[model samples]
Target: MSNEVRDELLTVYAAMILHSDGAEITSERISKLTAATGAKVEAYWASLFAKLCKNQDLNEILSSCGGGGGGAAPAAAAAAGDAGAGDAGAAPAAAKVEEEEEEEGMDFDLFG
Candidate 1:
């Protein structure tokens, strides 16, 4: 793929490819992939990208394109259910927690 380079983004794309291919994304590997695609990736940029991604959980990050909190609802519900089974007084606490969670989402409303 001898295409024109798109600067820093090329390095990021190459890193993603390496990650999906189950290859270690070192600066050398990023440089090689960018070069293979005819992109002249700077060595410093490659190293910086490698460093930035060193501790990232790429699999976790890619698992949900829609982002997080899906599991949180189910977990919170289960906790409420479990607590409700034992104590009647615990129900209000659970409801309060849910209300707090909802209020947090309303902090930045789309239609202000």
Candidate 2:
């Protein structure tokens, strides 16, 4: 493909990735690429972006990007609670002592 087409495609891909969460598009990101490259390129990029947004992968990406815990927080908390219950019901003191000993032996300095 020609440089013009490549640049347009890149811009579209970058825009889709950057704007995944309905972020405002700043002028600094536009650089020189724009929708005026060609009607076909513009249409293709729009279709690609639409398809990506419609897929479940977009949700996963957005959830991971949101940094708001998403669905993982509850699951992790439940698992941790279960583990604590199990530990409490079992030998807690023995396990805790071993963990402390292991931590004491861990390297404090990267070079060491």
Candidate 3:
């Protein structure tokens, strides 16, 4: 991906993580998160992303981008079934798998 696009995606991912954790999405937070991913981004881009996401509802934006709750049910059901079979850790593992799938889906939606 181009640097611009990559930076934008990193910024968005950082914002999502922050939002999910109920943390404030600030430029400093974006920079830290992007750095945590080991991705180098321009300061201006990071600032721009922070500004853009500050007032936006990320959940709504993601849903508009085809990330609404339509792909998680089966994975959750399977996990629940596994849990019933006595594997207490199955739910977290299943959730990780589902998250990976969702990330892949988001990548396709964003890049295509």
Candidate 4:
């Protein structure tokens, strides 16, 4: 990915980590986190992200992507099912199980 996109995504991820941990999102905190993770980002980007998130509700932002209560799962499942169906010999059930396992293995809790 481009540096701009990577920086943007890392900033969001760091903010989410701080929000989940009930900590304030500050440019210093973001800078420390990004630097620790070895992501090269400009100081302005970290400051900008922290400033934008300061007065914003993370939950509200997430909910706006879809209904906050499990709405994304069905869409993902439907898409996967459709893809599996496109190939006649493909095992939809197995593919779904593998996908679920992969998701279960993901660790979104960056701090712990």
Candidate 5:
């Protein structure tokens, strides 16, 4: 991914982490977090992102991505899910578990 996109995503993840931990979000906080992770974050972008997240409902924003805060982020956190070699193991395992769950039967049938 491009540096711009990476920085943007880093800001988003930092905000999510702070929100999940019930910590206050700030530009300095996001910049520090991303820096500590050894990634270069632009100060301007961090400030802009913090302002963007300031009044927004973090949880609602996260949930809107259809699994951004919960399941998928962790997969991305491992950094394996996005890499090609890791795809073989991660994707199949997830699919197999999902298939098994379907086989066991769901508690409620949405289509019914």
Candidate 6:
């Protein structure tokens, strides 16, 4: 991404982080920011959203895409504590058991 896009993405992400109390970013907010800067930031918003979907909750991502808000944002505080990779939030023993079950029941043709 270009520097301009990166900067814009960070700005929105920062704002999302700042007001992460599940409050929505209203149209008024978008209009005011546009007026002050004359910058249409929606493209950058789209890129930021695409990146967010890779790891964040799908429901939250879809809701944000539908509009500015009307959905819940993840807890910023929870993100602060490291989850130790894909296994971060999982219970060690439970995850191991699931992994074994997955190996026995793997379905490769699901994509084919």
Which candidate ranks first by TM-score, i.e. highest? 4
Give the per-residue Cα lDDT of candidate 5 at 63.
74
Q: Quote each prediction's TM-score.
A: 0.50, 0.26, 0.53, 0.57, 0.55, 0.23
Return the candidate ranking by TM-score, descending: 4, 5, 3, 1, 2, 6
Candidate 4 deviation (Cα RMSD): 13.3
Give lDDT: candidate 4, residue 6.
91
Q: Model 3, range 27-66, lDDT digits (tens) per residue? A: 9988999999888988887788778887788788877885
| Candidate 2 structure quality by residue, lDDT tens digits, 4-110 | 67755666565665576465434333332354444334345544544544434554665677556477868966776777885664446656887999999885788
Give a tens-digit lDDT track for model 4, residues 12-51: 8988888888899999998998898987987898899889
Task: Summarize candidate 5's per-residue lDDT along 1-112 as a digit string, tens digits.
Answer: 9999999889888888888999889989888899999998888987888898888897886777653457766767566556647457776777689799998886678988
TM-score head-to-head 2 vs 4, winner: 4
lDDT of 3 at 58: 78
- Top-scoring candidate (lDDT): 4
Off by over 4 Å in 1: 1-5, 64-112
lDDT assessment of candidate 6: 0.53
Model 2 TM-score, 2 decimals: 0.26
User: lDDT for each of the candidates?
Assistant: 0.82, 0.56, 0.83, 0.85, 0.82, 0.53
Which lDDT value does model 4 have at 63?
Answer: 68
Better of 2 and 3 by TM-score: 3
In model 6, the clashing pairs are 83-88
- Candidate 3 achieves a global lDDT of 0.83
